[model samples]
Target: MFGDDWLWMAVQWSPPYGERAGFDTSTTVMLLVTALVKAAFLWLILRAPLPGPLDRRARALRRLLYLAVAYALVLWYPIGLLPDAVDTASQLALWAAIDVLYLLVIRWRSRVLRAAAAALFAVELAGVADQLLDDLNLRQVHWGEVVGLGWMVGGAAATVLTVVGQWRDGRWSRGTLVAGWASLGVYALVITLNLLAGHLFSGGPAVSVIMDAAGLVTTVWLAATARELPTENSVPDLPPARLRAIRVAVATVTVLPIIAMIHPEQAARLTYTGWSTDCYDRPSFGDLKPAQRDAVFLCVARGMDGGGPPMFPESMSDQAILAYGRALCRAKDRDEQEAILTRAGSARPSWGVNPWDLVYVCPEIIGATHPELLRSAEETQAANDAYIAEENAKCRDPWPRTKGVVQATAKYFLFVDGDPGYLVHDPGDQAAEEEADKLYSGDGLVTVGRNSALVGHIEDVSDLCLTVKAFRTAPPRRTAGWQQVEEVPIVSRTGRLTVPEMGEDEVGAGAPMPNLAIKGKGRYRLRVYVRIDDGGEEQHLVVVFPGASRKKLTLKP
Candidate 1:
């Protein structure tokens, strides 16, 4: 009947408020007080001599209805009232109504009461299922989830026992009774573990677990007593005056808190006797329409002074806009500037006027007044773009590489300087010079120096044939398969450059080489295209021509 309030007690902490982390003292006090009231009320119903000659088990079951009304105030305040989520608030209302009905008639053997119990059980099962699935999907488990799972197990067990007893005319089968006792047994074990952990006093999580254990223990006791209730036809007879009193009591506890939850403003006046520090203290946008823009600015200034981030007002003075831009310019880094701008932009409606547009309109003034700032910003953007382009050319692109079957291993490299390994057989003095000719000689699909192309195959795949093609300018980009294109500047002193390898390399002293070379020792542009086919064979194509300056341009990191 208390629903997820038991689970909330298990996790005892409020949602973070800006920089404030931990439970709200007011909320904790409210929980403790309501719990005490529930205990006292239950004690009275069990021990005190009341007007009605109520069955002990039946009265225990009925008391849950009143307890539900009391706890709704405690649950609704933090979960829905504070957030102002209308849908969440509506859901809580629906849940409370169903729970109240279930508790009110759970002792009577009626189809309506059985249906209510089933519905309540369904809700609890659904919640537990969601939590279970969420935990399964999450990569890392948190301590809160562990505690929550423990609570779910206990709650589900109690719900199963209660709902089953209702369906079976308030009598538990032997097996069901065992399961109920087992669930309580587990709850006891968990309580023992919590005590052994030695944090039963102060910490939020520890205290909450102890509190939730107490709640579940109460539920188990109540559910156990409910099992002894007389069948549907044997319900205790109560006087009309007792019924009216019960109704009045439940309504008084339920309605007033609901009204408070609905209109928290009036509720605040009764309870909170302090100055309001909320955003509502400032004039709303509609109220500021007739007022000068200074009013909006001053309101925003006060909000910022309270350690809140700045926000864009509906209307901003040119001076204010300039000040914002200058502040961004003064930021230590681009990330900080973007963060400030993002917060300001997020505060305004999308269809409304943008603050940056106003600043951009007078770029000349910004550039002149903040010369070192704006001009450097442009340079910074250019550098950023250049860095992005350079990063895009990096060969370390991760797989899964654009949908293709791995047929043969093939990779291509562009050497601005001729292949470093061409004439370089390692270490010894005569070693490199002796093998230079054979290595440099245009052999099959391989070449040595002077833009000599050499293709190396994956280990034993040296005989694997690859197709090579070249374009005078540029080819239409390959839409399918993995591809990379980079514009490389070539400074050719002799003007002659070799085309990349296409076919297999025959390791022989003299092999007919392709007579593909651009004739010019001047500055030229080489656009290299490396592509991979579905069969995993690599294709290389270089567009060699005279274009772009040969001067080396170094990009900043």
Candidate 2:
């Protein structure tokens, strides 16, 4: 089960619908191009002329040729889309099919070896068949799990015999090497090597394409260096008509897999996956009706295997929900938008996303809890600008602008900005509060004083902010802003951002935040706005340096 889960995790290299990591259209296009080249190369190898008629190996070569041809065509664009639910089962079937092919080429002389190979073949075939039916709503795929032990036992036995039998024959035949190399390709494709290698390689469609390239190259080797087998003393036979008939048989089956292309069945519509999300490039969800919108999104989400890791921090769940919510918010109007966001509240475990735009859908929640969003976007921006001006006048420092991956229908980039008081000097007070709300107390960011440890890994850094809890007093008023003082500057870059090297002593000297990595030696100062829960607002400027006075604020867990 962990193998399945890890393979699923390893294969998620594609960015969400709209990501800001500069992973753009060109990279995706190149991925598609690689797959096509692999498919074409495989087709060429599969269609290579069979061993000469005088060769006793011709029968086996012809069968392998036919099988490989069918497999390549199906494994390409159209037919390979079976087991079509677009989940783990579908992925398993694709990889399992390759295993079946590897088992096929093992020359079993003993009855025991043949039986083991046959058993492995039968179980995998049944598993793959049940998967297709499972997607069609005809049956569940429980039997595959039940038979998997027998499947592995049979597979291992076949592999051992194949190797030992080849060793007994003195030299390794080119055919045997080709089959072994292709089997290794199958192993590499399904993550057998990656798991042992500790996930050093990246995944997604590109990895699968690499495996197919291996298969094509191995097939070429198989054909060019085919082993010389026993032949009859009689002259080479097979008349012109018979040779033409064999060619026709190969060509006919080669083209038969195209039926899936002509009538791809429901998998084309039902199975939306990472490989095919942009295949048709459907218009915005706002362009569809209620029923159509849900249908499209559900299919696409299933395809992409959306949902949180089984046991993960709340931040992971929140991001998955945010990405999906951003996609769903593309509704035609306020009425449709309400239908989508309202699910977060009604759904069993709440989505836990901030009610930033929920004002349009659930204003009651905001009016009672998140009063910050009561203001409009323009009002929030103006307030941020005014505060930035004050800081500039007093400290002669420009407010730092942080960027984020913006969705196509996003109103503005700060979907949920963390506290501007953290590493990022974000000017927006409301955005800062919402972003901080997710991280301030979560495993992602928990700050302590100079004597304590840091929270979160380097992955916590985003374009807009590095979510962190500063070892300073919680702002008394509705808003506050913080930045490294002129002396102990936190970063090394001027315009572009870069992580600074933090030594043990320096880290213990200033802020207790994990990502601070303070760069300078001398002390520093920062301005803040604060108000008591029951009283009027006030302003204060605090200094920071080695052995500076630090206050640890309690954050919500």
Candidate 3:
């Protein structure tokens, strides 16, 4: 039904899958040949004359053939994974009820039985009507769907009403005959829809038209025989035993497909011989066997020409690409490594992502061997260093003045670092024990590492004007805030620092302010001068300069 999907499936065992854009010449030829065969069968069904005036037995046999055709065409929906199968239980109940009612009316010609069957048919028609309403609106109705729906409603109504009339009146009327002809309209409607909708057939136009022709033939037979009621001792038919056997055969045909549906994997295991050779043109490629997946990876790593989209393109899952990359990482040969990396680079479709970034799956190897390719990180660090050098060069012996003052709560802290974390004040605060172990100290200000320090304030300090000034040498310090000074040694990774406000809990809770840019990445001496006014306002000066070795030193107020 799914065109090149099934056609190409024949050769899907070939390496790589889902890469085909259109049908090849051979597939096209095969489709045409298949279409011709289907057309021939359709022609035979629709135009081939009946052998003679078919008796009741002959008509019944022909109707069985029609049933077989229907089972072949439709049973796939339920037997496969179509959502329509969810209604199986209710549909089977309806069918059983209608079938029993039909048999009862046939045997005893009960008016009640006829009415019940008519009611069941009406219920079926109601379902069709509901579907019709759901499918199209008044202003945007597509006649194709409507006609397709009519085909179903018309057929069921014709069959049931004809049987009901037979039970009640013992003869067919013009109305029942017209109803039978209307049932034939299903074939017309479906074919028309296919054309009207620009040949949007479920299994392509060829397959759909054949099915429609087959349906039309079935409707023609049923309509032609609707009035041919049997008399006593009509031409000898199959015995009871044979009739039972036929019913069993039909039931087996119906049930086997359902059994497959219930355990499709078992069916696939039994039927599927194996996959095709190494070529990626299959419908689905996700669940590949380990060996097959490895082979594909090896093929791509060897730089084998895929001739179309690269194997394991960027569109694939990172996990899949990573799996391949990890396998490539296992290769120790330098040439092989380069070949794999080159292939990985080409497969990356997105821009701004370094080719080396594609194999971040093996970051340790790539980072160690090809650090230069990690330019994004390097470029960012360089830019930050340049900005810091420029800003730090503005520092002088007399600190440059600042403009605006920021307000803060009485007891807040300034944490200076490229990346700062919350402070752990209490040694008993076990929840933050790990952070305290790595970074806490007893002093008001303590340098955690080469790059970070925590500076605390206990008194209420508002109007906090903050500024940073840097010098090539340690410039003489001048008192600023409360004549309290704390000096700490810090190392700069990218020559940049930030001071963020810490809350009363000693946790860094406010935004970092007044970033400090110094000379290039290296060890530096940092001095903080604090001045507090009697009216609860403060001013601070920070000075940074080159230094070799230093320790934390604090002067209290």
Candidate 4:
């Protein structure tokens, strides 16, 4: 009976190491109190007067010993001894047995039984004391009360039994019994107070006062009601085999549950990965549906160099209007593009166009011809540029366009147009207004119109024009205003050039302007200056050149 099964149960019932109370002063005091209580109870039982029969007393002593052993088992194994279900059942059984045993002792009317019960009660008191200490030290009051309360109740019952046994045996006078009863009452009060303090303060030094009072009262009551010693005699003993069997049964019933609680579960040891395609770990365009995928692909394709291929085949039916829009842009078939975009806008009324789509590719078509449709796009770009300028100005830095040659380089990058009208206009006959609305409504077409003139110019020349502007910096000497200094220009001759005619009206005061009429196929440079009066300060110049490419010059005083 005492086998691996019992050991497993014990292992299961043992308290988890993580939950164990750390050793501390409060724990030590609890242990000390428990030891003192046990010693006092033992002294009382040993000194108690002999009852009518030695056998009755022996039986009582045996019962108390059993209870003491049970308390020890509980303390050693706490919760981990068995499976959760089994441990719960075992706990119920143990409590039931204690109650039944108490009832039997009361019915037997034996002083010896009472003494034995008291001894067992003392053991339970010790167990509870240790539990209380653990709770105080570990700050686990909830668990402590759960495990320790039972033991405290058992101890109180045992104390009362001892007092009754002494009184019935005629070992004490009536006055002494009354006093003992009164002492028991005081002990109960003290225990109640200890419980209250424990609940109120939880794990604190304040509880020690109550525990001390309870312990003192219990000790004094036990001492005052001490019984005379009974003579020792030989009694019938169980066979060795029977004794072994009983021991095995007791261990199996009591120790197995605690052992079972400590082992880790099998499920905790395994890990899972990539259970399904929707799982994040599995990877693939998991979030996009087929339509959304096609939408994104077609949108990106329409915005590619020269408005490239259709992202999806012509045969695909769902969201066909978007596919039609892509075909229009791809074919550079303006009538078809307009027709498709219009259809898309009608189908999806919530769609809004984006003007930035036309800002670069078809700026003239969208901005100049259909200004209302693309105004927001232009304003957005201008706002973005202003924000960047404001941030750069914070460091006392001049705008890059006002510096030497940088603006020309920047414009060269910005205005490089290989196939300008490629994405500007739809190839279909749909109205520009409808197409623009669809684009804005997120029908996937970038609605900004392309400049036919700009695209023609780029194609004709095959080269980009660079316009350079120059400005003078502030002088070292104190002055009211700045004056313009000499201007220098640098040219990048790599592409073809076709300078547009510039009118005199475009020139501003003291601005070194470009004379487009004198233009040649190769890059050229020109210098201009601003005149200042009284030499008040070094003048700063502003220059504007006609073309997509413009550079700036900074003149230091």
Candidate that scores best on lDDT? 3
- What are the RMSDs of all candidates, in order? 21.2, 23.8, 19.0, 26.7
Error of 4 at 548 (Å): 62
- The C-alpha TM-scores of every prediction are 0.25, 0.28, 0.29, 0.21
lDDT by residue for model 3 over 241-267, one digit each (tens)?
866775575344333322322322312
lDDT of all the models against the reference? 0.41, 0.37, 0.45, 0.37
Count the clashes in each prediction.
Answer: 5, 7, 21, 78
Model 4, span 157-246: residue lDDT tens: 665665676555554444335435555565565665554442233353324423433333333433333222233422234577876774
* Candidate 3 Cα outliers beyond 4 Å, as residue runs: 1-120, 127-557
Over 6-83, each residue of candidate 1 has an lDDT whose tens digit, in order, gives: 535433333322332444554444455445545543443243222344465456554554354334325545555443
Among residues 3 or more apart in sequence or in different chains, the pairs in candidate 2 whose N, CA or C atoms overlap within 3 Å are: 417-435, 418-435, 418-436, 476-530, 476-531, 477-530, 477-531
Candidate with better TM-score, 3 vs 4: 3
CA lDDT of 211 in candidate 1?
45
Candidate 2: list runs displaced more than 4 Å: 1-51, 54-61, 73-75, 80-109, 132-136, 140-172, 175-178, 193-206, 214-557
